[model samples]
Target: MRLIAPFLLLAALPAFAADPTPEITRPAGTPQANGVVHTLRQIPEACARIEGAFTGQAAEPYRFAVVRTSQNCQPRARFVDFDKAKPSEAAGWKFNDLIRVPSAACPSQQAVVRVWRKPVDVGQERDGQGQSRIYLDDAMKTAAAGKLPAIPMYAAAMSVEGKACP
Candidate 1:
């Protein structure tokens, strides 16, 4: 009985210390992201296709994006509004860092999730509306919607149009 007590205690020890699983750690730039929430107005020409009641005749779609444009409204070189603005003073809106979203194309479409980012452009202009227009094409829209990587103002300019981004 001299050493039987110590031997029994060692045999009773559990294999894993009976502790919980450890959390998985990720890389620095990569982080868990929240869904993007904002009001999206379809371009007037494309509005009719999107059937829904919005503030204006244009349709409003609430979609998720990997990288969301900042909610803060940044002034475009101090324009009184969109009107009476000079083209030289126009600038693009800065968005949050890249993120993951459910889809990229249309709200009706079920596509693989994607990641994207929108680079700010201070020299791009569209529709002759100066600061009133922020333009993006299908591809750029894909990025803004979180389909691709961070794009420059030039590429993003092709994807989005109107004052939406700014």
Candidate 2:
């Protein structure tokens, strides 16, 4: 029985080594290395009021991404209201002059969202780690602005009037 116990322990050791998990390290502000990078400017009051309405609901889901220009990291923002945003119909478009904010009701005050470099799995570029995340907020006294920081979900984010919202 003693000899059997030692053999069983030795066999289990190999299983543990075979399934080693990769550790994820997240830092403040920008991510280290190839992780997600979110650049949030102070969210304006108008934009925050609009996004607050859809805090819980995923009605106006936006997408954002990071791009490189002249070797400088400059984040680009675009309208990605995929649900209502249609290519042909300007009314469905989030950035068009027709589409107005449900809260502000101002087309000019509307913002744009985007999705950054999404983590690829089993492809030319695969970051076995989980997806990168980002978030956006305003000067509201609400929870979405305070309680739990609403960071952007990995590669997706939104921008309006030059402010980035996760």
Regions of candidate 1 where Cα sits further than 4 Å from its true position? 1-35, 38-58, 61-79, 89-166
Candidate 2 per-residue lDDT, tens place, 77-158, comes to: 3323433433332232121111112213332233333322212132223345754433234324445545543222122244
Alpha-carbon TM-score of each model against the true structure: 0.15, 0.18
* Model 1, span 1-166: residue lDDT tens: 9699988888867733532222222222222112333322112211211111111212332232222233453422211211232112124333212212222333222211111122334343455554545446865886788855332321111011122211
lDDT of each: 0.27, 0.31
lDDT of 2 at 8: 98
Error of 1 at 98 (Å): 15
For candidate 2, which ten residues in a row score worst on lDDT?
93-102
TM-score of 2: 0.18
Listed per model in order, the count of residue pairs whose N, CA or C atoms clash below 3 Å is 11, 17
On the 0 to 100 scale, the lDDT of residue 86 in model 1 is 15
Give the residue spans of candidate 2 off by over 4 A. Answer: 1-104, 121-153, 162-166
Error of 1 at 120 (Å): 20
